[model samples]
Structure formats: structure tokens, C-alpha cells
Target: MIESLESHPPQPRPIRWWVRACFGLTSPVGQRLYFYTGVGLMAVKYIVEAGFIRLMTGRTLTLLDFVNPLLSSRMQLLQGAPDWAGWALILWSLPFLWIAASMSIRRSADAGLSPWPGMLVLLPIINLPVMLLLAALPHREVERPYGETLGADDVSAAGSALWGIAGGVATGAVAFAMSVLLLESYGAVLFLSTPFFVGAVSAYAYNRPASRDAGSTLAVVMLSVLLSASALLLFALEGFICLLMAMPLAALMAPLGGLIGKAIADQCRGRRSHAMYAVAALPLLAALEFFVVHPHVREVQTSVEIDASPQIVWQNVIAFPDLPEPTEWYFRAGVAAPIGAHIEGHGVGAVRHCRFTTGDFVEPITVWDEPRRLAFDVTEQPEPMFELTPYHEIHPPHLHGTMRSLRGEFRLIELPGGRTRLEGSTWYLLAMWPQEYWIPFSDGIVHRIHQRVLEHVRDVSERSNGPPSRH
Candidate 1:
């Protein structure tokens, strides 16, 4: 039976927009108002936060850090900042959270979707798509009411799924070509935004013909991402290790696109131009990123205590024998492992050759403080990895010089009882976006390399002397 609102009069619109939007939980929200207001408020929030962060620390907060404000607590920029600043950022987010939740819940109901999905706004990263999807969905007609679920029968569902997956795959392929083939760069647009756009397009395609429940919609989106990824492998565009490394990123970004796509399909049932506009914008953004984005040098340091004195350790540090076969799986899986070290001359002007599994790093000695400090600038370095591909040899662009070793240094400190402290620091450049995510991988590999060399030095130094003499 159809319900009638004829007998009951509607509530008057509140004068203050905040009361209407933030506190108007029981009322329905229109799609345009929801999207625009959400975007406008978010922009304002960023402006305020950016100004505050800059004022407090004289440091600009990256988009990744600003998106998730909780990161402020752990950020180095906020280290010396007043305790109230961090707390203030946290407190500032509360009202926005309230506004988001309240708006999402109402918007979901208004769009004929269940209000439960609205709570997803609380989750980091995932909430972005949820909000976008909610905003994309058109408000349900007044007669349809809020409790109804939207979907077609199984036959239509299958057809939509197939089309959705195809659409998503095509979107991903195009994005891959534009970013990799044309731009020849792997920025966030390729790794992060593409998957999201693909997912969104897939979900939108799936629901365009006939709306599916959120579960079926998400399932289709996942399958689309999987199929698109498999296509890269099938066509030999990417290797297994690279794809495996990228899966987490793709998986993290895609579903939200699907959610929003599905919402858009359900609400604005006839808009074909919207998807086209999005598709067109992606390549332009990639081109802009190519011109604007540049990699920054990051340093990784590792230290080990040796049983022998600095004099003994210095001998091994300057030139070490071949390391034993690496037992670690990462090394076996093609990550470069240090092989040995050899020097051409004895002093500051000498050249050092550090051999790795892939090739050699040519280092020109800049400092030669015997038994104290040794530093060198890496003039030339070999490929970082050998891709585990089915093909005999595939030289991907990233393998060439994306991860570059700029310089390295070894510090030796004399310790009590004829001991030494050896510290190895490598400064390198990585051209990967969301540095927070990729830095760990590079840091971990660098640390392992440092450990291997340091341990070898320790062992060699210990063997040089008959035995350690305790005073």
C-alpha cells in the first residue's frame, strides 16, 4: 500500500543552514545541497587546518596527512607544536564528523538507500567514496518513501555485473596506457585514482541498466578490479611482483568508486555524460602530475655494535669480502642484495665499488677519516631489481632509476673495552607517491642491506684478532 503525506504538514525550513544540515537528522536532504555543502565545508576545513598547521610549525601538511587528521598526533611537524594544537585538530574534526554522519544518514534514506551505509563516513579513506556515492544518488521521489530497497531480478543482475566489469576493465586499461605509456610515470593518479575511477565506472555501469543491492554492487566492483588487474598480467604489461605490490593500493581505492558509481546510477538514472567527463579528466590530471611532481631524497640509517675496535672494523668497512648467499625470501624474489665491496685507491679521492646481485654502485670517496668516518657519493648504480616475469628479461621503467642511491656513509665510534659502533646511512630517491606507504619498503630493504654489510664487517673484524680481550 502507498503511504500519503497529504494529511501531515512539512516542517518549516530552518533559518540557519547549520541547523538544517547538521542537526536536521530527521529531515531529508537533496542531492545537490548534500554534495555542494559537503565539498564546500571540506574545502573550508582544509584551508583552516592548513593555515593553522603552517602557522604553528611552518610546515605544509600533505594531502594524505590532512585527510586523516589523527596522523597529526604522530607527525614530526607537530612534535614541538603545542599539545593543544593536536588536541585542537582532533576536537575540530568532531563537528565535521557529526555533520558527515548526520548528513550521510539522512542522505542515504533520502536516496532510498539504507541509513546503515551512512555510518561508513567514520572510516578513514573508505568514507571518501561513501560520501561521493551518497552525493551522486538523486533523492527518491516523495511517494517512494525511505524504507524501500532498490534492485532488479537475478537475470538483470548478471547482465549488469558483466557490463560493469567490462566497463571497469576498459577504464583501468586506458588509465594504465595514459599514465604508463604516455606520461611514463607512476604517481598517485595511476596507483590510487585510476583504480577508484575504474571501480566507480564499473559500479555505475552495473547499476545503470538495473539497480543492485550494495552487496551485489560491491561484488561486481571487486570482480572488475580483479579482472582488470589480470588483464595486465595476461597482456604482459606488468609483472607479478609489481602487480602483487599494487593490489593493496588498488583494493583500498576501488570499492569506494564502485559505491559512488552505484549511487549515481540509482539516483540520476539517465546521465551518460557524467562518466565521460570523469574519464576525460583522468588523463589531463596525469599530464599535470608529470610536469609538477618530483621525487624527494630520503635517508635510511642502521647501526650495529661490533666486538672489535674501530681500527679492525675500518679495514672490513672499506672493503668487505663477498657476502654469503642471501637466505631471505625477498632477495630470492629479485630484490637487490649486496654482494661485496672493493676500493680502487686508499684515501679520500679513491673510488669504491659496492657490488650487488643486479650490478655495481660506483661510489667516489668524499671523506676518508680512517677508523672514524667514510663517505662517498654514488655516481652510478645498477638496476634495483630483476622483475620476476615470465619473459626472459623485462626492463620496466621504474627498475631503471626510479629508486636511486644518491650517497652513503659509514660512521665508526670507539666503544669501551676495545669495541666499536658502526653506523651505515644511505640517502636515496624514490619517485613514488604517498611516501608514507612506499618509504617503509625502501627503508626495510636498505636496513637489511646495512645489517648484512655491518654483520660481515663485525665477523671479519672479530676473526682478524685471535680473540677479544676484556680489560
Candidate 2:
């Protein structure tokens, strides 16, 4: 009966003046202005709030720390709040943004366009023009209003919903089972590969009428499961992998999710095609992730003046201690530090293993270069006492394997005065979680850590010129 309703002609409604006005100004230029203005205002608000938080904390704030409190507390409160509250909160809270977006999708019956076009909003910049175009289109009257009276056609809606839910649940269960089975052995590879499956499923769901509802639900579930597993892996591994895993997942899932969403909208609303639009949107979203979301990994250099001869400072810096004092910060922090190896057998692959034991954690040396640089690649970590806490699990493979790439270098220059200028640079990548959700947080953390590490090196290097001191 529901399928047969498709033959009924849509009645026309008089377009409201305000709606017409909105549509008239919906040109590319006006859309761009509206979007840019909205984005700019959001940026300013975040910046000001960040500054205020930094002042209060007496330390630089990262995006994660800023949202952590809200995610923990006010998230539930937001659901019952008004529409303005939903919009404002979403502007501020990353997690809520997804929900707010889902709600923004009105039924196709309310708008003249097929429901599939609603998926366009998921595309980045391209969605702006599409939305304006949609607003400009005329509305259609409902042939048979929903919930006014029961009709045979209503059965299809119920069937569609049921099929969607069942499909989503079944797929999610299978993925979860696969993940669990693979957890002990090929966990890393399986976790890394999840994004591809998610994308494929999402694509399949949107493209097929029977699968639409199920696909969206399954995507959400899969996303949650993958995220949890990935986070666990990050804690276990703790370095490059955290960031690496996110890239493939985002590349696949984002565009595919958008496509599926558009497909569902089209089927419900009777739209023809959105193929060209989806093609254009994929790269734009990827670009946004690369430039706007990814954190900058920079090598910083600074010179610290020390009232010691260059030879003496160089000797101390280059000394390959068999059992170095635990005072080295990285050593004490339980991160692997280089101890007894050189960069190469003669030039590049030397291995130094320095160990640090801080109260909270221990670091072991992963890479060691004498006289110039040292690197720590964290492979193992202490177990967490709590299950739900972020730090409780072992860093994932992505984070652990990649973290070992961090390197710090020191250069000594002789001065006319009986002093040495110690120049140093530290290089490390910022491995962030939930890439899109925590972009601002990742940027803030990287910036603050970079500043702090440089400052510490300067203070320590300069103080070394005096009598031996504790750090």
C-alpha cells in the first residue's frame, strides 16, 4: 500500500513571502557569506573561550580539555533544551553536533524536494549552495497527511523502519563479533581496517531502498564500537598509530556516510540523482580534515647560553650512559629513551635505550642517536585502574608504533666568551583521537606541549652551566 501511494499526485501550496525571500537570497554568493559568517563567529567564540580557560588554568587549554567537562556533564541536559540551545550547544560541543545535524533533517513531505537531498547537508562547503537551492524550491501539499488516519500505505513506513533497524543491528553484531574474535592476535590490523567496512556498508545502505534505515543505524553502531576499540589501541600503543588510524577511517566513512544519507533522502522524496554532487564533496571534506583539522607537527629551535666550554657541554650531551641517572625527564616518565647506541652502525641506525621511572608511568628508549639526538618510542604502558577512563587502557598500536618516531636534537656552538650556545630542536607528531570531534583539542594540546617542552629544555640546559642540580 505504501509503495502504491507513489502514484498519487502532490498538491501545490502557496509559497510564503518570507520563504520566497529566503530562497531569492540563496545564491552562491549569499550562501557563502552566510556560511563564512557563521563559521567566523564560531571561530571567534572558541578563541575567546580558549583564552579565558587558559587564564583560569594558568596553562594553555587544548580542545579536549575544553569539551571534556561538557561531554561528561551537560550533554544530557542539552537533549531536552530548546532548538536555539541545541544549535548553540552544537556550535560549542563536538559530540552534540552529530545529533543536532540528524535532527535538522525534516521529513521530505514538509519540503518539496525528495528526502534524499537532505543528505547534501552532510557535504562540507557544497552543501551550502544545495541548501539554498532547496529553500528556493516550492513546497508540495501532503496527499494523505501522516498520523491523521491509518491507511494501508502506512504499512510500508513501518516495514521500512523495521528492516532498517534489523539490518543495522545484525551488521553491527557481526562487526562486533569479528572485532572480538580478532582482538588478541590481529587486533591492530582489524581495528585499522574497520573504516573500510564502515564505508562499504554505508554506501550499500544508502544505495539500496531496503537497506537505507538499517545502514544508518549500523553505521552509528559500528562507529561507536570502532571508536572504543581504537581508543583502547591508542592507549596501548601511544604514538603515530592513533593519528594514522583516524586518517583511513575518515577518508572512507565520511564521504560514504554522506552518500548513503543523500540516497535515502532521494528515495523518500522522489529526486532523480545526486552523483555529481557527491563526487565533488568527497575531496572537499578530505581537504578540510587535512588543513583545518590536522594538527601541525613542527620542529622548534632555540639557543640557550651556558657559561661552559663547548667541548664540555657537548661531552655531557653526547655521553652514552650505560646506566644514566634517573633524573632525565623522559627516563623518569617511563617512556623509552636512548641510552647505549648511536644513530647508525656508523651513521644512522644506532639504538640507545634509556629508561625513566616517574610515579605515574615509565618510558623506555626506542631510538638513540649520540651527541646530537635522542628518540623514545613507547611500546608498552602501565595498566589503568579504571575501565572507563581514557588513560586506563594500553595505548593502541597506531599510537605506540608511531610515538617511537619522536626525536630531540642538541647542537653546541662555541662563543668568544667562555660560554657555549646550546641550540636544540624537538620533533614529534600529534596523535589525536576522534579526528573530527577533537580537532581543536588536538591543536591546542600540540601547541601547549611544544611550548612547554622547549621552555623546559632551555631552563635545564642553562642551569647545567652551574653546579649539578636536580630537575
Candidate 3:
């Protein structure tokens, strides 16, 4: 029923170029640059990020950061931007976003689907499957309401294979150069730009009916990722660990990128000539996104329940003895593990020092509601982790200052069973892009820290005949 409703004939004018560049409707679409068109234009986006964008950020971006799973965040929300540059960078993203949206719109229209489906191209996570499904859909007989219809495409399997090769080469060079040279050490380069570039370019290059199949799109993207990965490895630009981490990302992102590229490519022709110059622009855009849009720090919270009274727990909460040796392998590796804490002073202005393997967190007490709540602000802190790197001395920017424990607290919620729901929260900032990769580690580290404290508190409280923490 839905298909029957949207499956209308091509009963409209061609979508215009500049208009098509901005919007996906009305202008008469000429030269459906489907595969080639998408690739070339996509490259333009990267070029903007790599070139004009780098001048904004004060950090030296490097390819090493791209492959490192634990790269530090370059978000400037804290330090702020160079007034004009920050806002200007944001404004610049408009065309890049619009072009991407327009490409998807045209692709959807070419597939004889509604324009609304095109917006799915802009989505994250689910965008891949959505694109692949759209690519698999058969092209309908229509006036191509979004763009001008072209004649039979000469794109063959062999041509597509070549396209994949070409796109891979282009993707690797631009992605590396953008990250290393432009200093766009943001996560988007590795997580968004690289896979997307290869996937989209390969799918478009295929430029054949088979390109519409999910299998074909998936295969092309996989091939492109492999080729690109191989090249990076050969150049020593990427390490084995980085490649392993990048696998799932490539699996999802590449296919999604290819399908979106294919859909857009299906609408226009003629990028065949200009694709070279457009692709040439990717490094620039990669740099721009890095400088203009620095990754922002975010916080995560975890809680647990202890079978001890708040009065009993508050003692250990304020300060405790040393923690037992960690049995967890992660703790033994490189992640920071908590030991114990002790406080100096008696009231709201008291100081607390919680020690970890790497360093001590210097905290100052703020609110002290005995047996009920205890809070403090992190005034000084230590490095997040000791390098698990297989080197004599390992120091990465992320380990030193990227992550910070801004503040912390311990809350004791009274339950009817003479027990307390102990919730320990560490207000910390993760200054890293693609938090998806590093967050789990951060969360675990905090939890382990909390667990050590909470459990110790429980032990001490239950063992002693101490007075209840009076409200």
C-alpha cells in the first residue's frame, strides 16, 4: 500500500543545480552524477575539513590519533573557540550537511521513493541498514521528480571493481592527510569520514543495476575498507590494534556509506569529469570539521545498592583503608584502579584525597549531610591511566589530561529494611571523540573505583558497632 502510494510516474520538472545542491526538488536534474558525482562532491566535503578547518584548532592533528582507540578529545566547549572561528566553523558545516542531504534526496527520488526517506541518510547508527535496504529496492519507472534521467549506464562489474580500487586509494590518502596534516584529530575522521568515503565512493563507482543490491553494496564497501586498511597498514599509518577496533565500524559504516552514495549517484550523471577535483577536496573538509567542530566532553553515571545502613556506610564514605588487589585483567592492564581515601578537616570546607594507582584525586567537601549525603568538588586530579602500551615509557595525550574527575559524591538512600541504597557518582568529563570506544573503559574504571569503596564501607560498617550516621 505504501509503495503503491509513492510509486508515481516521473511527472515533474528537473531539479536545478544550485537549487538541487541546496534542496532536492523542483530544478531539472541534469547529469545524474550518481556514483562519480557523489564521490567527487563527497571529496569536496573532506577537503573543506582538512584545509580551512585546521586553521581553527590550536592542536596538531595526527594520523596516529585516528587509529588510537583511546585518542584524546579536542573539544573546546571548556576553553572556548577563537570567538569568530568557532561560530564560523559551525556555519560552514551548512553546505556540507545540505549537500549530503540533497544527495540522499536525489538518490531516494531516483529509486522512485518518497523524498522523506532521503533524510534517513543523515541519521547515525541505523543509517547503514536503511541505506542498504534503499539500495536494494528496484528502480521505478518515473520522470525522476528530483533530477534529470540519464540513458543506460556503462558501469560494469569490472568498472565497479576499478571504482572500488580508486575510491579506496582516494579514501586512504585523504583520510590520513586530513587527520595527520590538518590536525583534525577528531573521531569523525576515523569513525565517520574514512568508512563513509570508501563506502560511498565504491558504491557510486559500481554505477550498475547490481549496485542496487544489498549484497553488491556490502561487498563493494568491504572491498574498499580492506584495500584502504591494507594501504594504511603498509604505510605504518595504522596498527594491528587499531585495525581490530576499526573492523566493526567498517562493517557498519562502509555499507551504509556505499548505499547512500549509490542512491545519490543514481540520480545524476556527469561527475565523471569533475569527480577528480571534487575528490581532491576531501582532506580540506576533514580538517575543517576538526577545527570548527571540536568534540565536547560528556559525563556518565553508575549506581549500586549496598546492604548496609547509611550510618554505617558514611564512615567509610568519608575515608577508608586500602583496597584489595584487583582480580580483573583490565585493572591489571592499563586502566586506573582505586586504592583508598582519607579526608582532612571536619566540615563543608574539608579536603579529601582518594588515591589511585596512577595518582591521587584531591577533592574538597561541599555538602555534608551525615548518613544521608556527602559531596565534594574535584580541585586537583591525576592521570587517567598508566600506559598498558608495550613500551619503556608510554605517554599519550589522552592518559595525561583528556579525562578529568570534575567532582564526586556519595548518597545514602534509606530503605525500610534497615539497609541503604548506596549510590556513588563521579562527575567526570570525557574529552574524547567517539566516546563509544573509550566510555566503556571509563565507566568500568569508575565502577571499579566505586565498587572498591562501597564494598569496603559495607564491610567496615557491618563489622563494627559504630553509631548510626545521624541526619
Specify the highest-TM-score model's number: 1
Candidate 2 residues 41-143, lDDT tens each?
4466567655644443344545554444222222222222222432343345432223212322332324443333444444433444554554344345655
Give the top-scoring candidate (lDDT).
1
lDDT for model 2, on a 0 to 1 scale? 0.38
| lDDT winner, 1 or 3 | 1
Each prediction's Cα lDDT score?
0.75, 0.38, 0.59
- Model 1 earns a TM-score of 0.74
Summarize candidate 3's per-residue lDDT along 245-304 as a digit string, tens digits: 557656666765666566545545442312333344456555554555433444444455
Compose the digit string of candidate 1's lDDT tens values, residues 176-262. 888787777787678767887788789878887777888988888889888887777776777788889888777766876676666
Q: Which ten residues in a row have the lowest lDDT in candidate 3?
A: 72-81
- How many pairs of residues in model 3 come into backbone collision? 42
- Arrange candidates, best lDDT first: 1, 3, 2
Residue pairs of candidate 1 with colliding backbone atoms: 133-260, 138-267, 200-257
lDDT for residue 393 in candidate 3, whole number 0-100: 49
What's the TM-score of every candidate structure? Answer: 0.74, 0.39, 0.55
Displacement of residue 13 (Cα, Å) in model 1 is 12
- Candidate 2 — worst ten consecutive residues by lDDT sum? 21-30
